[model samples]
Structures are given as C-alpha cells and as structure tokens.
Target: MIKEKKVSSRFIYFFGAFGGILFGYDIGVMTGALPFLQQDWNIENAAVIGWITSSIMLGAIIGGALAGQLSDRLGRRKMILIAAVIFVIGSILSGIAPPNGHYFLIAARIFLGMAVGAASALVPAYMSEMAPAHLRGRLSGINQTMIVSGMLLSYIVDYLLSGLPATMAWRLMLTMAAVPALILFFGVLKLPESPRFLIKNNKLDEARRVLSYLRPKETLESEINQIQEAAEQEKLASQNTSWGSLLSSKYRYLLIAGVGVAAFQQFQGANAIFYYIPMIVENATGTAASTALMWPIIQGIILVLGSLLFLVIADKFKRRTLLTLGGTVMGLSFILPAILQKVIPDANPMMIVVFLSIYVAFYSFTWAPLTWVIIGEIFPLMIRGRASGVASSFNWIGSFLVGLMFPIMIATISQEAVFAIFGVICLLGVAFVRIRVPETRGYTLEEIESMEESRQAKQKSALLERAGL
Candidate 1:
C-alpha cells in the first residue's frame, strides 16, 4: 500500500502537468516553423507573420474563458481530456494548411489555441487541488518544467528539421504535436479526479480514496474533512458567485494580484524573444536562419536548468521576493541591451542573446512558473474556475498583443527601442508585485483566502478611519 501510494502520487503529478508539454510545444514550434514558412510562402508582410504567430493567443483567450466555465461545472480532469481532443484535431489541421494561404493555417492555429488556453488555466488549478499545501509550489511548478521541456523538445525538432525542404520541415514540426496530445489523452484517462472536486460534489467515499493515494494514511482523514469543510463553505458562497463576483471590491485585490502577475509574466517580453529570436538575430547580424536556430536550444537549456532550480527553492522562499528580484534583473537585462545599442551603434549583436539568457534565467524560475502557482493559490474556491480563466485571458491578452506587435514594433522602431519598452514594463511589474501580490508560500488555499479577506478588512477599516466614519 505504501508503494502504491508513491506510484499513484507520482503518476497523478506527472500526468496532471503533462498538458503543459503540449502547450509549450505548440508555442515553441512556431519559432522554428516561421523562418521556413516565410521562405517557402515567399511572405514579406509583417502583419501576416504576426497574425500567424499570434492567432493561437486569440483562440486561447476564448478557450480560457470557456474552459473556466465548463471546468467548474464538469471537473478539472474532464476539461483536460476535452482539451486533449482539441489538441489532436488542431495539430492535424495546422499541419495540413495549404501553402500561400495564411488563412487556413491561422484558423487551424486558433483551433489549437483553445487547447493551449485550456491547459494554461487547467494544469495549475488541477495540480494545486491535488497537492498538499507544503508541496504545492514545487508540484505546481512542475507544469512550468513540463512546458519548458516541451519547448526544448520543439527547439531540438526545429533545429534537426531545419535542413529539410522548407515546406516539409515546418509541416512536420506542427503535425508532431498530435503524438503528445494522444499521450496526454491516454495518460489522463486513468488518473483520479481531484480530491477537492470530489469533496465539492459530495463524494465522501471517493474523496477519501483519492486522498489516500495523495496523502499519507495518518493525515488522510483529517485532510478530507478539511477539504469538506472548505467545500461546504464554498458551496454556500457560490450561491452568490458568478463572473461578476470577481469585480466585487471585497475580492478585487485578489483579482488584481492574480491577473497582474499573469499579465506581467508575458508583458515582460519573454515570448517576444521566444517567438522572434531567430528573426531578431538574423536582422541584427545577417546570420542565416538555420544557424540562428541554435540559439533557442541554448535558451531552452537555460530555461530547463532554471526550472529545475525552481523546484528546489519554490517552497522555501517568499513568492513576492523572488518575483521582485526577478523583475528587477529581467528589467535590467532588457534595458542594458537597449542602452548599449544606443551608446555604441556598432556593438556586437551576440550581447543581446547574453542579456536575454540572463532574463530567461530569472524568468524561468520566477515570474514564468510562479505566476500560475500564485494564480492557483490566491482565488476563493467559489470563483477559482472563472477567476482563473479571467486571469488567463489577461495573460493571453498580453501574449497576443506582444506577439502581434513585437514584429511591427521592430519594423517601425529599432530593436533597441522595442527592448527599452519591454524593459520598462518589467520594472513596473516589480512595483505591482510588491504592492499588490500576497505571500502565498506554505499556506493552504483556505488559509490564503482567509488572509485575503483579512487584508481586505484592514483596507476597508483604514479607508473608514480616513473618511471619519
């Protein structure tokens, strides 16, 4: 039984976060495919390239919203299964899109975006629900690890396939997503539903069984009772909960904290580098696309290493501290590149990659993974699903705008100017974290919610005293 518990817990965590692999692969695959696709299609329009790259984010916005509503009604596990199916279908459609017609490819990518959006919102929530509070940060961070692993895998695929004919190379890079989507489908099929969900649905026996697989025998009963108590209160509060509940002044700080972290995670300009690094490198140094592909692999390795480090430190430190330090470093990294380019016009372009690596090192361990971790932790259970979805939409909104505008920005202003703008955003992110985001480490979801309520009460009392009430 002890061995079974270990195996079951490992299985649950691995597959629970496995959806991120698909999410990362789809996001990274485009980096390699775009260079070849542009050459093959003889495309020169920056807007078209931006559309092809960013269309998935647009779809993700919709997917995140829809999945949030549905997952609340259905279950986290079931929503993942549904997303896996969408992943398979979308991957195939994306691969088969015809040459010279951006519309079909864009449409297919948008279809795939639904799965990406769903995974973004679902994986962290699912993992958090299943994990013990002490381990939630590390366990939840695994989704990010899986995401970067998938990205590294895609970068390797892109590099390996770079030598093939342009059309064939990009096509194969996309179609390969189906393989993992199928794996996610089969893998998730056997996993138990979240114990929290079970308790919410009043399945006491099943919740006990699920918790047994996750928690030790000593704590299993107490954990289940705790979850039940939270669920009972959540059920009462949910009677008044709706999408509008997020806007209530009582919870608005939580909403700001969750959504601000998510939005800043993207607006820091990380994806802009991920999606267009080759182009940036090529335009800067006139390097061939094939040679430029090697850089992503280097960045991917750093990201993976940083993610590994995050697992070690995730539960040890304050979330706000890590984010503030990371935001500061990331802001500086971008700012230095922009400043150097302005100061010395003939500076080596490779320095941009160096600074970016510093940025990625901080991001992989900090804002990238912790955003989802905090989002999963901060919301009230009654509104976790909808609020998470809304936060995700804001995240994708940042991603979509960055993806679409980065190229246009590069074309109009210089790369240095664009980098400067991203740098400023990163610094602003630090301010937001310090002022608004709560310290969520080592707290249960119930505890975090209560803490937020207390914080809200304090703020209200302070306001009343100031108003002479």
Candidate 2:
C-alpha cells in the first residue's frame, strides 16, 4: 500500500510536468518553422520578420497580465483547461492559416501566445503547490526538464519534416502542439486541484483530501498540518494585502526583486538564441538556410542534457552559486564566438556549432531552470499570483523586445557585436544576482514568507518609532 501510494504521488508529479512540456513545445516550435514561414510568405525585411516572430510574445504579455486575476478567481485547474482550449484553437488556426495572409498567421500566433502566457504562470504555481515541500525543488525542476524535452522534440520534429513540402511541413510542425495540448487537458482532468487553491477558497476539507493524493501516505498528515498553518498565515496576511498596498515600501522591494529576476532572465540573451538560431548558425557557418535550420536541434539537445545534469546538483549546491556560475559560463560562451569570428574569421563550421552548443548547455543547466524555480518559491502565497504575474509580464515584455529587436540588431550590427552585447548582459546578471538574490534552497515556502514578513514588520516598527506614531 505504501509503495502504491508512493507510485501514485510520482505519477501525479509526472503529469504536472507534462503541462510544462506543452509550454516548451509552444515556445520552441516556431523557431525552426520561422525560416520556412518567411520564404513562403515573401517577407522582405528584417523588421517585418521580427514583428511576425514576436507577435506571440505581445499576446503573451497581455495574457500574463490577466492570468493572475483569472487564475485566482477561476482556480488553477480551470484556468489551465481554458489555456489548453486556447492552445488547440491557436494550433489549428496556425496550421491552416491562409497562404498569403501574414496578418492571419500573426493573429493565430497571438492566440497561441495567450495560451502560453497563462500556462507559464499557472503550471509552475500548480506544480509547486501540489508537490511536497521537501521534494518541491525536484518536482518543480521536472517542469523545466519537460520544457527542454518538449523543445528537443520540437527540433527533432522540425528536422524530420524539414525536407517535406514547405506548406505541409510548417503546418505539421505548428499543429504537433495539439497532441500535447490534448494530453495536458485530459491529464489535468484526473489530477487533483492544487491543495493551496482549495485552502484559499475556504474548502479546507477538500484541501486535505487533495493533499492525501499529493503527498506520500505516511507524510499526508504532516503535509496537511503544514498546509493548514500556511493557510492561517496567509489569512492573517490577507488582512493587510490589496493591489494598492503592494506599492508601499513594505512590499515594494520584493516586487522589484521578482520583476528584476524575470526581466534579467530574458535580457540575458537567452531568447535571442532561441528566436534566431538559424540566423546565428548561417552567420557563423556560411551554411545554406536549410542546413542552418538544424542548429536549433543541437541547442535543444544540449538544453535537455544540461538541465538533467543540473537537477542532480541543484539540491547540493547553493542556488546563488549555481546561478552565478551559470551567468559566468554564459558570458564566456558569448565571448568565445565573438573571439572566433574576429581572430579565426575562417573558423571551422563544426567549431562554431561546438561553441554555440556549449552556450546552450550552460544556459539550460543553470540560469534557465533556476530562475523559474526561485521565482515560484520566493514570493509569499497571499500575493504570489499577482507578484508572479507582474514578474512574468516583465519577462514576456523582455522576450518581446529581444525577439523584435534581435533580427534587426543582427542585420545592422555584426553578429559578433550582438553576441558581445549578450555576454555583457549576462555578466551584469551575475553582479545583480550576487548582490540582490537570496538563497532559498532547502527552505520551506512558509519559512521564507515568515522571514520576509518578520523583516518587514521590524522595518515598519522602526519607522513608526522614529515618527512617534
């Protein structure tokens, strides 16, 4: 019975990670498909291509802004179901989009962006809420892994379909997401609602029942107690929380920190590579566009492998240390390509591939997964939805900027300069994280919240005493 219960808990977590897989697939599928899209659509300029590429991110920005309020009102499960539906619609529209109607394709991409945005916010929160505290890191990390896996699968699918007729090929690639979207919708049906959502809704008994399925049987009672305590804390905190209150000094710093991390994650040039790999590869190798399209697959593979390796060490290492190291490695990776381009102007294509692969490897293991893990865990539950949404909004905004600008930047500036700029951004990330980000590894969410509140209370009291209030 114990073994069965343990297996059941594992299965639940696996299904939860599946949601992330869909998120990754949606984000990555368009990378390879874009080259074919531009040619088929008769796109003539970098600015136009950039706008088309970033249309989804613009929709995502709106979706992310709305996600918190909707999820809080509708419950995580329901919001995810809605997102799945939107994903299906977007996939179908994109697959059969009018051949010459670029605007229609943009509209479809925008719809898909909305689904991606909602899922991005909800999935990690759901996974974190459902996971046992001790195992939360690993379980949440699985979401990142699944995201990479989905990306890898997208690349493989694109590579395989690359030789097919362009119209059918791109359509098939975009529509492949429907398979995972359907799987996520059905998988979520069987999955229990997040225990936190239930507690927040005043369904304490239901929360406990859900906890039974989420935690191992032996740990169920203790998990329930932890949830009850956290709920009580949240209730007390709620008395002081409102949208307006978040702007005050007490909460302002946390909000800034959250948004900073989110913005920094994207501004570090991760999406530049993700959105423009084929172009980067073409610039580096002087390869034909068709051959350059496969480069993102190499990136996807390295991302999967690196993230898996990171999972092993994440628990053992300090989170800040890992993030710093990742930033440094990423910065160096960017510099190497620039150096090769300058010095060896005629460097081997394989060397360029090797260097780019190393860059992806560094990003996947460290910055990519850890940023989401830390963001999901750091904020208090009472304001988590809003705070996370705010942060995610910044993230998507940065994604939009990078996606919209990278192509133009690469066109105007040398590719070496583009990479050099990213390297500098990464170095700045290391400095910011080292100074501002706190280590939260091995700490429970409740404990972290308590610590933050305690500090806030002390600061508030100090100000009152000074003002003679």
Candidate 3:
C-alpha cells in the first residue's frame, strides 16, 4: 500500500538524508567530549590524545570500503540499517567506557566510526538514485545540510551540558548520537529500496512499483526502460566490474577525480577547525577550553546557514564553476590572516576567528556539500559502490591525517603558518577542479558516462590527427 499511502517527496528525501546526522554527530561530539575526556581521565600524552581522536577516522577508512562493497551486493537500504545498528551499539558502549577503560572507549568509537563512514557513502547514493535528475543535486544536498545540522545539534548539546561535571557531561555528549541513530533506523524502514538498485539486482517489478511512487505516472515506463538499458550497456562493457577493476584505464580518471576531490575536501583543513577550533581559540585567547565554547555554537549556526543556501541553488549552477569559485574564496580567507599577521605582528587574535568563520561560510556552500554530490553522481552504476567506498576511504584518510597532525603542527609552529599551508592547498584545489573535474549539473548518471565516453573519444581523435602520416 506504499503506492497509495506513500509519503511526500520531501519526507522521503528528509528521511534519506537523516543518516548524515549520524556521521555529523559523531564528528562534532568528539570535539565537545575531548575536553572533558582530558580532564576526567587525566590524560596528558599528545600522541595518546591524537590516537583517541583519530581512531574514528581509522575505522571510517575501513568501514567506507566495506560498506561500499556490502551495499553493492546486499543493497543500499540493508547496509544502511546495519550501519544504524552499529551506531546505537557503539554509542551505548562508549557511554559506559570510563575509569580505566580507555582502550574500550577507543574500540567503541571505531564501531561508531564505521557507521559514520558508511552513512557518509550510502546516503548520497541512495538519495541520488531515488531523485529525478533535476532534483538530484538538491536532494543529495539535503544530506550535507543534515550533516551540519547534526554538528549544530551536538554543539548545542555540548554548550547546554558544558556546566555538568566532566564525567557525566562527556558521557552524555558521546551517547547522544544514539537518539538520532534510532530515529534513522525507524525512518528508513518506511522507505522503499532505491529503484536503481532494484533494477540492477533484476527486481524489475519492484523497481517499477517503487518508481510509481518516485516518478510521474506517465514517465514511469520510459524511466524503467532507460535505467534497464543503462545497466545493460554497462554490463556488456565489462562483466567483471569488481572492486579490483576500478584501477583499469577506463575508470581510472573517474576514480582519480572522485578520490582527489574527496581527499582535498578534508586536506583543505576544514575539519581541523571543526575538531580543534576550540583548542585553537584557547591558544590564541589564552583561556581554558571551556571559555572557547560560545564560538563553536556561532560556527554551528553559520554552517547550518551555508548548507541552507546550498539547498536553494545546488542544481542552479555547474559543479566545476561553483567549486572553483568556492575554493578561491576559501583560500583567500585562510591566507588573509597570515598576511595581516605579517603586516602587523600584534594583530588581534580574534581576527583569525573572524576569517575562519568566513571560511566556514564559504565551505558550507561549496566543498562541504558539493564533494558528496559529485562523488554520488559521477560514477557509472557498475562501479558506484566500490568507487564511492574507495573515494570515501581516501576522505577519511585525509581526515585522520589532519586530526592527528594538526595538534602537533600547531604545537611546533605558528598557527598562522599552518593555516597558510592550508591556504596553498585550497588554491591548488581550485586548479584540480578546473583541469580534472567535469561539469555534472543536470545530467542523468547514464548520460554522464556517455559524455565521458565522447570526450575520451575526441581526445583520442585529436592525438591521432596530430600524428597523421
């Protein structure tokens, strides 16, 4: 009766995007939890601290790869349900780990980390598959908006709980993820499996039924035909489209572009601000981490705003153009502080905070959301699962490196210098988009692959013409 009692399109997209909250909450929860962790556990070793923080990224690296392959075989919905279960169990276990259970805490975080990475990879794909081509960007963009909203929620929770005793406060912050994880579990159950996934698995009738709810009644037949034909052509091109074949020459460019954007999105140093911005603020202002609290809430608000803006215009512009514009502006935001510090060595430390806020504003609309959109939409159906997994793993790897290294980088060098390096990386990211990334706005996944094929053929023709006898 789902066809008759089907929810509105807004409900479907909102529920689909809910998984992102699981990832975002875990990401921001640790930021609030870590300060209390140091005080409650009396931990002082920098390496140990870095390990605890980065362990989630470590597990995420593994989980993204595993979920990619699992979603391919088991279907996206089932894999997502599995991830939600993992988050609940992990969060509950982390809540209880204290008083000489440091390793246990790390292990629990790894479990949650797996869930985070899986959701990060799966939700976008699921939404993109269900949405019509015209709405895919905005629908997939809902995932990013939910992600920042999750971050905002965690920050609000942290601020509200900042006054409680350290042990009780941090435990609550870490366990808070279970609430939304449970919500997503129940929510996804009401949804149909992705029509494309159903088609690929040869459940054509089921795909037709799902599309009856997802697409216009008149377009359902042609939509099914188009989806089926695309899968058929991809299957004929390569029967052995396993994870190992992603490295093949034909797919190498996509894998590279996808993974490159994913990695640089992290390496550009946005998370350093998210995870350790309080610490950065503490150092700059010569105050306790507690005093650094109000700023993150401000950040959370700006992040939510930028994501809201993305929701409005995501499908309105070409991907390459927006990404290029965002990167240039974000680069300037980072570098301008260093320039000011050099021009006046006694520049108000708060100037750095203002610049970082601008950076977040730019990030929310551009790299923050678009990276997920491109990763979800760029791959052909045959390799989407494994390729997205690989790309996501690289993203977590960059996140891990930044989380582990940033504290040390700040301890050893001037913080402005570190941000300047990130500025250079951002400018370089703009070049990567201009040269390597293709325009993907408003294109069907099948048509995107065909476009790539045509471009490759033209390049080959040009090479041959230049060497004509």
TM-score of each: 0.90, 0.88, 0.88
Model 3 misplacement above 4 A: 1-10, 202-217, 237-251, 377-386, 442-469
What total of clashing residue pairs does each candidate reach? 0, 0, 0
lDDT of 2 by residue, 244-292 (tens): 7667765666676677878888998888888778877777667655567
Model 1 C-alpha lDDT per residue in residues 1-469, reported as the tens digit of each score = 2222323777877787677888899889999889989998998888999999999999998888788678878999999999999999999998889878799999999989999988877887788898887776466667788899999999999999888998899899899899999999998888877878878777777778778777889999888888888777767767879878888886788898999998999999999989988998887788866569998898899999999999889878899999999999999998998888878978998888789889999998999888878987898777776687778778899999999999888889888778878999999999999898888888877788789888878989999999999
Sort the predicted structures by lDDT, highest score first: 1, 3, 2
Q: How accurate is candidate 1 locally (lDDT)?
A: 0.86
- Candidate 2 segments whose C-alpha is farther than 4 A from its true place: 1-7, 214-222, 243-253, 349-351, 380-385, 442-469
lDDT values for all models: 0.86, 0.80, 0.85
Clash pairs detected, candidate 2: none
For model 1, the superposed segments whose C-alpha errors exceed 4 Å read 1-7, 131-134, 202-223, 242-245, 380-385, 442-469
| TM-score, candidate number 1 | 0.90
Q: Sum up the clashes in candidate 1.
A: 0
For model 3, residues 1-469, the per-residue Cα lDDT tens digits are 4353565677778778777776888888878778888788987676667777887888888787788678979999898999999999989998889585778888888888888888877887788888897775466567778888888888888888989998998899888889999999998887888888899999988888888887889999999998889778767645768767788766777888899999999999998899887887887788777657778888989999999998888878888988998899889999999999999989898899899999999999999889988987889877876787778778889999998888888878889899999999999999999888877788877888887788888889999999992
Of candidate 3, the 10-residue stretch with the lowest lDDT total is 1-10
What's the lDDT for candidate 2?
0.80
Q: Kindly indicate the candidate among 1 and 3 with the higher TM-score.
A: 1
Clashing pairs in 1: none
